[model samples]
Target: MVSCPFAVSCWNKSFPGSQSIHTQVLEVWLEKMFGKYSDNKYADIVTLCWALWRARNDVVWEKKYSRVNRVIASAKQYLLRWKCAPVTCSSVLFRFVVEEDGAITWVRPTRNSIKVTVDATLFAERREYGLGIVARDADGLLVEAKIKCYSGTVTVEYVEALGIKEALSWIKNKGWQEVKLESDCLAVVQAIRCTVEMQSSFGQVVADCRRELRDSNSISLLFIKRSANVVTHCFARASHRYPDRTFDWSDIPIEFQDCIQMESI
Candidate 1:
């Protein structure tokens, strides 16, 4: 499911409690879903999975986009038309309302403060890595955005640590004292907070990030769900394509516009 771009956003929008478990593997997700909605939910889940798979295949093979909501609605319609067993009170307890704008949307920063969001993506097979850092004001206006690349041996954790360190340096250089440094990687965020430490060489990177963060004034390191950090995720993927490119608020490329627009709402 991780390989399917639509799966993450679909589950997040169509189901409640998705933020905590969307990152789980497919089997675990299915297990949790069924466990939570066991009262005649088997048929519902079966229909949902079939719909999503067919929707994904349509995009992959026919070059057509399929909205997740439409697919889910079709699945439900099919179940009703086929006279499937009715869902019970137990299933009602787990019902989730679909989000209209999808899940990967932006969030505002604290009042009178700056928010710096960073993300990193690794392509292990190619030994390539990319980092994205974006800053926005309290009103959610873009302050700056940067994309960086590294062609060396590194893990995703190390790349995330690097993202924190580099983003801090950029923030410090910009003279933003009261700021929030956010990332989607929970392990790295906890490691930076000194709550946990990696035993591998990546531990040193975390240490360096902590030391760098310690010198910053009024900077808060936070972990956010991936859904709320879509802009950074998009930029991280962009960095792999355009290595070492820097885009200011006015100069950001056209591809970023859609995600930014989605979040602005």
Candidate 2:
């Protein structure tokens, strides 16, 4: 975009067009706003422009915003999650047995409250993560069952930690007050019970999660052998990518793609 006379003006022979200062400024602004738009040419450009304009107004008129501050805070939060982690002590695993009646009668609880078993297995070649949770209700009939798929891959310890978190979080989010969480991973269950604080950043994460869970009066953390959580173990194994049947009495989530496999009740 230029101003003033040239030897031959395309505008002069073809047509005359008006250029406003605001239009030039808007172009520069849109470049910053839509550099990523190359991948989404069909996106709503008008809505994007309106939002950017509004944000600018809020900062200019109300002195209320700073992009740098927001980005920095988000980065800090992401880093904190990595820095603060629990110590990976040796884990204890329990094995669950399948009764002849095909019903789970009981799960021996270790450490406390009615125990619930949780596990996760991932097949890197299959590009999938399997998640399972088991708990015996009042009737001792395997009252609750949960299984699903995930997309990320990490070590077995990380997966076990995530599985426990998911099980406990499910109860918390549902507003349940009392529940015992059971897992085969001894190290993880211990991390959930006693607080670990080593001035190291990794310890910080474990301590933080401990503090958050500690406030929940209704929750208890316990350890059990992997064999004690038979159903979930089978479900975890069934999540293999080789195309097989899997069974689950609960409503399967679409992301799990369980139907493509063989075993689901």
Candidate 3:
């Protein structure tokens, strides 16, 4: 049922949405199947859909959809590997209610423009590259996030360079004027601030971002501890699992929805 231009590229577009919901319920109902499932991550879905289905379940389609609340619980149960999670962004959004000053201070609605951070790393274990970028609002709520398998095996420095470039590209495309780019890769900081030419492939990305972002006076780059960049860590793990897919989100599986959520958190 994940058909929206983005759904077609996912293994099969015609797959039943109701069936997906049914499968979710059955996994919760059947302790055996649930036990067998490690992460509830179908290779076709990239952990992202698991979240969208959970957090946004109330945003329904037609009358023939799964119970929104159950879907959220099932997704949480499946992901947490426990009967339930203590609390998550989705859970808070769905359950929390506060009356504050008749004025809505913050909301996590789909964002239009936001400040962002990006990280790219190449696993020394496999030599594969990973890229992830996350957009956050002024209040630090996540808007949209993405991770992808970088094409071809690459060097560590190059992956870091590519990560910064990708982050800049993301902001520019979104028409963001001032972005505070951060990365754990020291090489990336050197590449941007020091103007040292990176490896050829990564250099191209860096060059592109420099050109695109340079025109803006608001953009700046910073270096952060790797532990601070958790989204990219998840993304790096994901790059190892689903090494390659089309660039479009439609081509990715549902599991990635969780990755996006995790990054935001």
lDDT of 3: 0.52
TM-score ranking, best first? 1, 3, 2
lDDT by residue (tens digit), candidate 3, 1-265:
2443332323133223323332434345234323444554342243335544443444555433333323442343344333223434454454322221111111222334355556766666665677777666665555556677755677777777776776776677777755666666665565665567666786777777677667777676665545345544555567666554323344444554444443333
Q: Candidate 2 regions off by >4 Å?
A: 1-114, 198-208, 239-265
lDDT of each: 0.74, 0.49, 0.52
TM-score of each: 0.60, 0.45, 0.47
Query: On a 0 to 1 TM-score scale, where does candidate 1 land against the true structure?
Result: 0.60
lDDT of 2 by residue, 185-220 (tens): 677656655655556443454565577577788776
**Which has the higher lDDT value, candidate number 1 or candidate number 2?**
1
Give the best candidate by lDDT. 1
Q: Candidate 1 vs candidate 3: which has greater lDDT?
A: 1
TM-score of 2: 0.45
Worst 10 residues of 1 by lDDT: 95-104
Q: Tell me, what's the RMSD of every candidate?
A: 13.0, 22.2, 11.7
Best by TM-score: 1
Candidate 1, residue 50: how far the Cα is off, in Å:
17
Which runs in model 1 stand beyond 4 Å of their true positions? 1-105, 195-200
